[model samples]
Target: MRTIHAPRLLLLLGTSLVVRFGQTLRSEDRERGDVPGWVMITLMSATLVAFILVMAQGALESMFNAAMEKVNP
Candidate 1:
């Protein structure tokens, strides 16, 4: 429906613009600041979040494959 699609399109456009602006600001800030602690915390958090997501994805894929094999065979 138009109503559902219009909001989703607007949300996607808004998020893209915000992400671009934030990327520019982050690059500028990295050059201007020597906040080692803040950078380390951000990097550590990102690493942990990525690790969790990857593990979750692998587990889900395994479970789905097992289910599919059982169902098909």
Candidate 2:
């Protein structure tokens, strides 16, 4: 009898489960009549912009402070 490759078998099983989960999510979204493409795109874009702004907040504050100090001196 041949020995089983446990690691390879587990990896294949995990991949299959993930694919099936994605398919199920897609089907549910279709059934729910999900939001339109344009709306989704707008929402995603806004989220990205918000994230960028948040990440840059500290840098913006430092730049503003530097400019003010120069102007006041």
Candidate 3:
């Protein structure tokens, strides 16, 4: 009997599940909203932060330092 390693077994199982899920989604082909919205929210938030950092970097840094000082001291 051939033995499969643990990592290899997990990879195989993950791939099988992904393929099965893809097949199920294809068969349904309607109301596809199986998305983790956090992804988009995170991207949007990062973009907003970048804009804020560019616009008010000094103000933001000062605010952060003040907050940290209050927390620490």
Candidate 4:
């Protein structure tokens, strides 16, 4: 009786701990901590790309056309 009860008690405790840990993880996931970081990175990358294109539109077009001609022909 004691052995059976002890195993069952430990299993119940372990199950409760696992449930609590899972709840903590879920709550943490609801917070968008890194979303702003990602947004900033995306905006900065887009701005950089726009700046580069504005500065070198002709050069990039010529490079792209040359590469395509080499690949297809």
Candidate 5:
């Protein structure tokens, strides 16, 4: 009579499931069409511009205040 180690059996089952899931995801990704190059470029450019504007917002506010003070004073 042979006895199976329950922990080892569970580990093997879990590993096989993860492998299968990864393979399925890879296959699906292969089947999907890639995003257009221009779309990605535009999205990246917009993101960079937004980040720059957000980072410089404080400086912009101070510049605007200085200009306003010069005009008023």
Candidate 6:
């Protein structure tokens, strides 16, 4: 059995997060109520922190292990 690595997985995950965040911002703009710049900034910052804490570390580790398995197997 093989496992994934770390750096490559983190880079991939970070890229995906940026893309998702962009989509979310676009969706927020389309909502009926207008979002003030400050509020939007605050929300985005908070969401980013939450994403980092909740997903980035663990997910990247798991992805790396999976990738390693594929490569070695």
Model 3: per-residue lDDT, tens digit, 1-73? 9998654554565555556655656765556565534444454455555555566878889999999999995
- Put down candidate 4 lDDT per residue, 1-73, tens digits, no spaces: 4554544554555455556545555664667676554554555555556656666889999999999999995
lDDT of each: 0.60, 0.60, 0.61, 0.62, 0.60, 0.63
Clashes of each: 0, 0, 0, 0, 0, 9
Segments of candidate 4 deviating more than 4 angstroms:
1-32, 71-73
- The Cα RMSD of model 3 versus the native structure comes to 12.7
Clashes of 2: 0
lDDT of 1 by residue, 19-72 (tens): 654665667466656565455456555555554555587788998999999999
Off by over 4 Å in 3: 28-73
Best by TM-score: 4
lDDT of 5 by residue, 1-73 (tens): 8776654554555455556545555664654454443444555455556656666889999999999999995
Where's the lowest-lDDT run of ten residues in candidate 3?
Answer: 35-44
TM-score of the candidate numbered 6?
0.35
Residue pairs with clashing backbones, model 3: none
Candidate 2 off by > 4 Å: 1-35, 68-73
In model 1, the clashing pairs are: none
On residues 1-73, what C-alpha lDDT tens digit does candidate 6 reach at each position? 7655554455556566567656666774655454444455565566566557555778889999999999995
By lDDT, the better pick of 4 and 6 is 6
lDDT of 4 at 9: 52
The total number of steric clashes, by the backbone 3 Å criterion, in model 3 comes to 0
Better of 2 and 5 by TM-score: 5
